[model samples]
Target chain A: MIVAEHKPLKELLALVEGFDRILMVGCKGCVSVCNAGGQKEVAILAAALRIARKRAGRPIAIEELTLDRQCEPEFIEWLEEPVKKGGCQAVVSLACSIGPQYIAEAYPTLPVLPGLNTTFMGGTVTHGVWAEYCSSCGNCGIANFGGLCPVTRCAKQLLNGPCGGSVDGFCEISPETPCVWELIYERLKNLGQLDRLEAILAPKDWSTSLSGGPRKIVREDLIL
Target chain B: MSMKTNLKGILEGSGFAVLAAAPAVCGTDLSAVSDFARLLKGKVTAVFAADNPGARVSASALAVSVKLLAEGVEPVLCMTTRDRNRLALESDLLGAGALGIANVQIVNGAHPSLGSHPSAHRVYDVDAVQWIAAATRIASEKTLISGEAVSGDPSFFIGAAANPFVKTPELHLPVLKKKVAAGARFLVTAPVFDAARLATWLDNLKKSGVTCPVIATVAVLPDAATARHLARAGRGMAIPDSVIARIEKAGDKSLDEAIAVAVENIQAVKALPGIRGVAIIAPGSETAIPRVMEAI
Candidate 1:
């Protein structure tokens, strides 16, 4: 899932400062699951913005709405009616950067602002904790290392790692982060596949990753 | 014969090899290299041009290595996987070979976040072991990892870093063996503050069948404050409380005590069976290196 967090309130306040009225949009996708840009968060942010504006002698009107997901065109169409009603001069999207980008593409006249910063593609590790698990490098070879991805987990992203900096199974970057190579080594050892590590993995082909360019997917058979 | 063979000969020879580290060789001045070479001329074996010590950005170690070689000193260019991809690594190796810099120390560098640039993206395209393998293939096989022919002789006397201070040295054995298998001719342990710990690490290395020549590092602390700082930093570097206490208790003689401690460790390191040399790392006190070497 794409994890995101709210931009600072000051920054959000500045984004909608010039507008007399604005529509705040939220997404119920990964952001909602991470408790960042959910319906409840949208309402809370709207209230906070209104209060901060009112106290500053510049009370602004804001209409809050939450969509199923902001990345898709179908969910984005939901903002059409409210935007057409015409008092809304700007839009504050509480989804990942994709939502604001999508809104800007759909309604070219209005200024679409990002209310949250898209951090990483990650999953919930605990009740309210999330950690990055994938880099979306487009090349998946985690199976060889017993389902662990060094490209995403290791700080240096070395194919062969647990560099000399690995101390007590923890990464040199932080004590909280486990050395992924150590995890892979231990996992492969337990599975009796330690031989997998004996062969030096070749240098990664990063053309499949963001290094190539902005990526896209097209299925010829599914195209209408 | 290649410079790599000459270096290997020095390492395998009965005379103890003395490597002096010249950290952060990024400035416009080559005087530091000349001054260091002049100071250790007859006494030292090679000058190690470190790659971004403390993760701070510095000039390429190969460039510094070239400078050291020009100054009549053999150079050990420290190349880290932290900054370059395999192509760049190979290109640099080819360039180093062209310049006649023979010795190369491959290690996974310190994370950029630990350095001056915390926001910089890291490119650890290859790990240390894989890099050692790639370097060996480039040198001996005369082919790049992509199997393209390397034009010139890029032979390297390859060395890899080993952290002797890890609490459990046994867990580090497999990787050590893998490093040796990957063509690391020698192993350089992280700075040793405790000789007993180094002895234990050497014992473990011998038992694990890693009989390669080992160069142990000894950091010369100038005072109790630096000792405390190193102890607190703890990046797989072990500075036992007893060692720190000795420096602190020395009062006005803290600097002498620090040098004495380094001298003592160098002697103990030299006595170890698998040990080939001692690399003196005196971060800000390069002058103290001669004293340590003289005492050892």
Candidate 2:
């Protein structure tokens, strides 16, 4: 889901104060399901912005466009023609951190402000209900423990077992959440692979999914 | 999750009922206001204030309604904020509260075309949702136009309309959500003349995750056939084939069929998991609503 923290309305109002034509860009792919950067949210934000502006007596021109996904180059191109055509003073993006970077790089002269706080990758439970559940680390280790993730849960990313915080099968940090190692233990025990936890989990490999120069993936067969 | 304290919670032990008595046209005299209030004493009963400056049934019987509620009756104040400005709204709220009446329904109100004052200019500084928000902001924040908080807090049980049976169910859902977000505690729909349409609307509300208490409105007509001859300004109201068929079989001479139709719709709606209560609207047949309430 598009995991994003909503920007305060006052801050957004301040940003578009003098801009004649403002475009509020929204992302639909992940943020839509999470109820963050979707068409509905875009409409709400647009109306609120107009109302706020009207209340302030500015009454500036404003428009909204929600693209499929802002992170990809193909999707970001859809906005290039619209922005140029509208002569937009500024483009406020409602996508994650990666999205703004792409927009800025695509059009160096246009100013792009982000409308979401860019939270962690997560999923939805129901409409208006979203919960953070994963941290993509560009690794596949789920086979060892019945598909339960530990990188996002183990506090210390301890794949081996529980530290001292597992109290009555619950994590100490949050009373509602289950302990990572406890879940691992239960899953391993159920899968007839009880001996897997016996091996000490060494410090996890840190070569992938970290703050570095720039990350890229290679698909050798696609070039042909 | 939305905060609790819905209409059901308010009326469960308080003993109350709404009496929809909207006059078919304007300029109808309401000399029997106190009599209706007296009849509904120590129980929930309401009579619509006809769209007339000559008479407002609620205002006419304000003193009596107050006296009745003082004896443990719950008086609900219903006003559509179409032409009425903030001063009028505040007076109504304060006056009702002075009379121990707390329940209030905020409506965008009907246009003047429904009345003799069609030439009257519509005064809407804000719509129904904004009006309700103003009330909530006053009560919760304890302030007024100048950002000054009142010395004492205001207590109100506010409700708004939701037409789930409307063909544009999508628009209704968003509008209802907006109203709720703006601080409407419950929903009183336009009218439910059909059972299947009511069921469909209930299902759509559930799927849409609207948790507010909705009171399905069973319209009370002089007869079933007259009710079916609906015109514009209120369109897409769902009427069941079974109800229509029943009306056709009964021909023109059946007030019993209309009452039966209203009773059946009430029962059908209440069975929906999300539905909380029923609000009966009787345009000309104001007296019949209480009977349906008693039957239910």
Candidate 3:
């Protein structure tokens, strides 16, 4: 899922400056699952921002609301009433990076401020610990590496590793992070698929990735 | 067991010779390197290809090798898979070969984080072993591992590096085996400070059936400060305490002591059974090559 984290209160306060009334928008999709830009976090940020502004002798008003998902235009339409009718001059979007853009496009006049930093598309590895597992290279070939993604996991993104610097199954960058190739090796070894490590895969076609710029997809059969 | 007392003697009967590593830095003075290489033109066998030494990206090694080859000097190109993917590597192999550069050393290289551009994403699409495997395939079959046909065979004299000072150095035998099996024609070890450690490592390699020609590395530090810095920054270059004390006590003559120590190391390393030659790495002290080689 897309992962994001709330911006620091200091930065958030600086972003909403000059705005007397603010609407805090949250997302129930990826942000909610990651405990980052969810409804609960929106309330916490609203309260914190209010306290910070009040302490600064410039008390402001904030309204909290969450949508099913902020990236989609249909879900973004839900914020029209609060932004148009309510006294909100600006919106603080606590959703993935795409949220603020969608909100801005929906309410063109209202200032849409992003309250979260979109980190990566990853899953919660453990409680309160999130690790990036995919590079979203627009190509998925984890089946070849025993289900481990070197593009995101290896510090060097080595297609064939562990490099000479790997120590005790740990990456050279940090001991805390387990080397991805080491994990792949163990996984391949266990599955009796070590021979896959021998076959040199060709260089990745990065045109499908961000290198090729913004990507879009349309299914002809599914299209109206 | 002192086989040779000088560089000339060291290269007298062996297939290898002392090659100088011309490290490329952010603002590398290539003229100075060219001058150094010229000074050692006939004195040494060849100059090492600039493999982005010190992990800093500089002029391509192939460019340097081509330049040196034009000057009638052999160049050994160090190809680290850290910077390029398989396509770029194969291209470089073919390019180096076209430039008449034969020797190529494959290594996983230092992590890009250690280089000047720490933020640069490292592309280790293939490690040293896999890279060698591809190179060997390109040599015999004239085809890349991807089955892409090349115009001509690179037939590179494939070399790989090993660090005997790493933790439980003997355990690296399996890794050495993999490299040799992949395609390493010869091997070079990390700089030696403690000969005993390397001896044990070599013994283990032999026991494991490694018969490739092993070239020992002898790093020359100019002073105590350099020694300490290398010890801290280098991956497997641990300076022995005894050698450190000797350097510290030498005071104004520390460089002389370092050279003497390096010479002594060359002697000790040459005595080892499996070691076929020595490679000298004296970055700031390139002049010391003549001195060390004079006594090799």
Candidate 4:
């Protein structure tokens, strides 16, 4: 999931303060996991704004809605009649970066802005800590580095091997983070392929990762 | 008298900078005393992050950070809301006063993910600003959230973090002021470790009229291996080439120069008015803080 952070309250307030009737739409997928554009947070943001406006005595009319997924057309259709009926001036999306654009595309005239900063596609390290493991570089070079990624894990992104900075197996960045190369070294050492670095690896081909342009994946049979 | 002026002049000349200190532990200690010296040496204030230098931050680590203050290292006491619950927070604040760590930074830390217990309930009942508001009351010797009476007050220089780079960046300023209005006495930023980034962002904060203690952060990488890990963290952190070069040249050479870079960077940031302190984030180099302070 692409984990993200919500923009500060004041930033969100400034964004929507222009409109009286606002619809805060959230997603139940990816963002829900990251707790950004998820149901609970959208409710919280809406409640916060209501409390804030009421405190100041502005009392703007704000509506909250959450869909299974906002990036899809079906989920957006759920908002049309209600949002259109309620005369929502703007739709605040609590989904990933893509979901906002999708809403804008569907309702060209309707304004859409992100409520969360789409951070990265990462997995649960602990229950809550979600460190980024992939830059979505096109190539899945896991086989080369023994499941651990030197590209994403190493502080300097050293493709070759560990620098001298590894002390007792932890990266100098902090005591918490382990040396990525150390993980690689340990993995390779376990695999009995310690000489893999001796073969002289090539520089990372970043185009495959999601950095170059719009990225896509396909499985022909499953695609249809 | 002139000596004090000269020292103040020297301190003021250094500019805006902050020293990052987490609770010092056996592994992840936020060793405040050592960090206080770094702030003093760099002529920067310290925003002590509540971390256990020995390992993961436990209740015991906070106790250690508090005790260290007695060694004449009365620096700022900093923490994320997630680092401790309100109960623990209240306890630590009381302890900090006992140790004499007057300054404090409050933040809503990221909830533990990977290494954390998944089923643990998030106790963010209070956010950073509210926590500050609550803690500041303790400084006044008022009643606490638990309705407990204190012998004295919780005297503190409260602080918070402001993200300078955002859409409508100017808007964040008022929020910062709100935190200040609520209880915060200072503003410690997740400072742009990059000098260029720092200059532009500092300029923006200036335009916003947020004239609090805008203590800029000076993160110490001092090693290539650590720089790589920080790069992976991919937070807004910017690692300069000079830093990487310093690390590369560090080799078997005595880490004295590496440690010097840490202090020197703090010294450099002290020239900025907004940069009131340095957060000595030596990361794994918790013990190295004293050495860095020696040069400062």
Per-candidate local distance difference test: 0.85, 0.63, 0.79, 0.63
Model 3, position A120, has a per-residue lDDT of 91
Docking class of 2: incorrect
| Listed models, DockQ each | 0.59, 0.01, 0.29, 0.02
* Residue pairs with backbone atoms closer than 3 Å in model 3 (clashes): A158-B124, B5-B296, B6-B296
Model 4: lDDT equals 0.63
Give per-residue CA lDDT, model 2, range B119-216, as digits (tens).
67655434566567777666677655345666554677787767665444542465566677777877877677666777787788778777777776
Maximum-TM-score candidate: 1
lDDT of 1 by residue, A1-224 (tens): 99988899999888888897999999999899998999999999999999999999999999999999999999999998999885699999999999999999999888999999999999989998899999999999898788999899988887764676777778878888998888888788789887786666777788888988999999999988
For A39-65, candidate 4 gives per-residue lDDT tens digits of 899889899988887787677787888
User: Between prediction 1 and prediction 3, which has the larger lDDT?
Assistant: 1
- Candidate with the greatest lDDT versus the true structure: 1
Best by DockQ: 1
- Rate residue A96 of model 4 by lDDT: 87
Chain B only: TM-score of model 1: 0.94
lDDT by residue for model 1 (B35-80), tens: 8888887788888998888788777788788777777888898999
For residue A90, model 1's alpha carbon misses the true position, in angstroms, by 2.1
Q: Could you tally the backbone clashes for each prediction?
A: 0, 5, 3, 66
Predicted complex 4: CAPRI docking category:
incorrect
**Which tens-of-lDDT digit does each residue in B181-200 have in candidate 3?**
88787788878888898898
Model 3, span A1-224: residue lDDT tens: 99888898899999999988999999999999999988899999899999999999999899999999987888988887887778798999999989999888877787989999999989998999888988888999899889989888987776654555566556666668787777787788799997776565655667788777999988999977
Clashing pairs in 2: A2-A30, A2-A31, B16-B44, B17-B44, B194-B240
Cα RMSD for candidates in order: 1.9, 19.7, 5.1, 22.6
